[model samples]
Target: MRIAALLGASGATGQKLLPLLLDDPRYDKIITLGRRATGLRHRKLEDRVVDFENLAAGFDGLKVDDCYCTFGTTIKIAGSEAAMTRIDHDFVLAFAKAALAAGATRFAYLSAANADSRSPVFYARLKGRTEEALKTLDFADLGIYRPGMIVAERTDRRWAESLLFPALPLLDKVMIGGLAKFRSIPVETLAAAIAAFSMQRGCGTRIHHWQDMVTA
Candidate 1:
């Protein structure tokens, strides 16, 4: 089988996933696209440095079996709500359009746990809108993963999550249902699940919640 693309090949989860994709025999060719070059040197790896918002032209010649999107940003680093939405929602939608035009077989997205298009929170609202847009694409296999508080060692995560980690133990005790026991999952675990689920055939549009990942 031939593997097509990795959209966020430089981010936290994407970094861990790169090695696994390189080592896996299922994919003969791996194409990657991001704002900056990944500087990843491999026989099967083709890295493209371009703006995700304007990927339609850049994606003209690309074809892949699956498009894995682990791309995300925070409001702090993004400087403003508009910028964050641009990267997190607009950019992702652009990539999805390109992928569909290229006739990709599947689209895998990394969305947060509390995503809701009608949510009061702006971040979650954007994620929800993006998820809704992806559903409209009608890909044969559409997988959305909602991971909560991914714990990656030596990651470049924003300071907010870092500050919240210390309180997790106490929070877990008092929190209930999905909010309670909101255990921080490791990045490797999330990436492994993405790889495993992406390989399976015949799965339609499905959303995997936080507990599903913990149990899977």
Candidate 2:
């Protein structure tokens, strides 16, 4: 049995992944580290409310074999690019480092499509930088999933996203060939793929595109 550490357990993908992790027999303990409670109770679940800025001080007692990160935020919601970077890049690496110190051998991160460290786009550049930083850690296994528009119900509303969400399914059908990676995927499917991939004991780094995730 494995001990798993999860970040962003309250986010859209994280919320969907939490129950799946609990149901899987491979994991004996599922530890969630976040700012607030997941409000979920299970025999194998352990939720730890943490301050991301001071993660090392609070993460000493946790022991995990694998770590999964689904933490993310938009620039609009964060109110500034600096704040968004602190959460999306800085905080994520901080938690990952702490998880490694706790003996985690594998790490999984949910990234976005078109993530490139040299990209002119701010969000994609941040995601790319985060991915690159994780690779420097050199864990036994690292899985970076770059998913396109994630289709899910969100508590925080985005006017533009709300307008586009309904038409994504119809758009997905037409987005074939090279455009397949842009096809929107359900949060549940993405969550399941993350859970399933975490169990694999492969070595080195692997980047899962939209096609790989949907078919996983």
Candidate 3:
């Protein structure tokens, strides 16, 4: 039996993940922390409202075996680079630290494809930086999932997704070898893979791309 703490339960992928975790027999309890409630109830689920800016205070005393984070935001929604960084980078690392202190030995983070710390792109760089920062926490196992186009119905749909999704099938055919990581994937598949990998004892850090997630 395991105790799992998850952040970002209200997001697309996280919403999918919450039910899976609740249904999985491996987890004895599931704790979800966020700025607001998930409005979800399960026998094994415990939702807590936490201060994203000061996670440690709100997250204290909640011990778990594993912690998974799916928290993310775009620069447009966040309104500024600093604001995006606060949500995507600062808050994520803060949660990892809090979870670690609370006796969590495993941590899982939802990053994105092309997340190179030295990348010229701001979003990729931020994700890469967060991945790097997570490694320093000394979790027994760290799973970083870098998914490409997450295929999901979104309430706040992006124009780019609308433009790109139709072309995704053709792009997937041509995108082979090194570029396969960027291929589009269903959010349900992605969520299942993230849940499976995080629940296991893998040891050290493992980075999952499209092939990694689908194949696993």
Please give, for residues 1-216, the per-residue lDDT of candidate 1 as tens digits: 676688888889999887777777888887888877789789988887886658876576876788888998888779999999889988898888888888787888999888899999998899999999899886899889998788876556668778987886676566668673356778998887777665666899989876677676
lDDT of 2: 0.89
Scanning candidate 1 in windows of ten residues, the lowest lDDT window is 174-183
TM-score of 3: 0.97
lDDT of each: 0.81, 0.89, 0.89
Counting clashing residue pairs in each candidate, in order, gives 1, 0, 0
Candidate 2: minimum summed lDDT over ten consecutive residues — where?
Answer: 55-64
Residue pairs in candidate 1 whose N, alpha carbon or C atoms collide under 3 angstroms: 175-180
Cα lDDT of candidate 1 equals 0.81
User: Which regions of candidate 2 fall more than 4 Å away from where they truly are?
Assistant: none
The C-alpha RMSD in Å for every predicted model, in order, reads 2.0, 1.2, 1.1
Backbone-clash count (model 1): 1
Residue 161 displacement (Å), model 2? 1.5
Candidate 3: count the clashes. 0
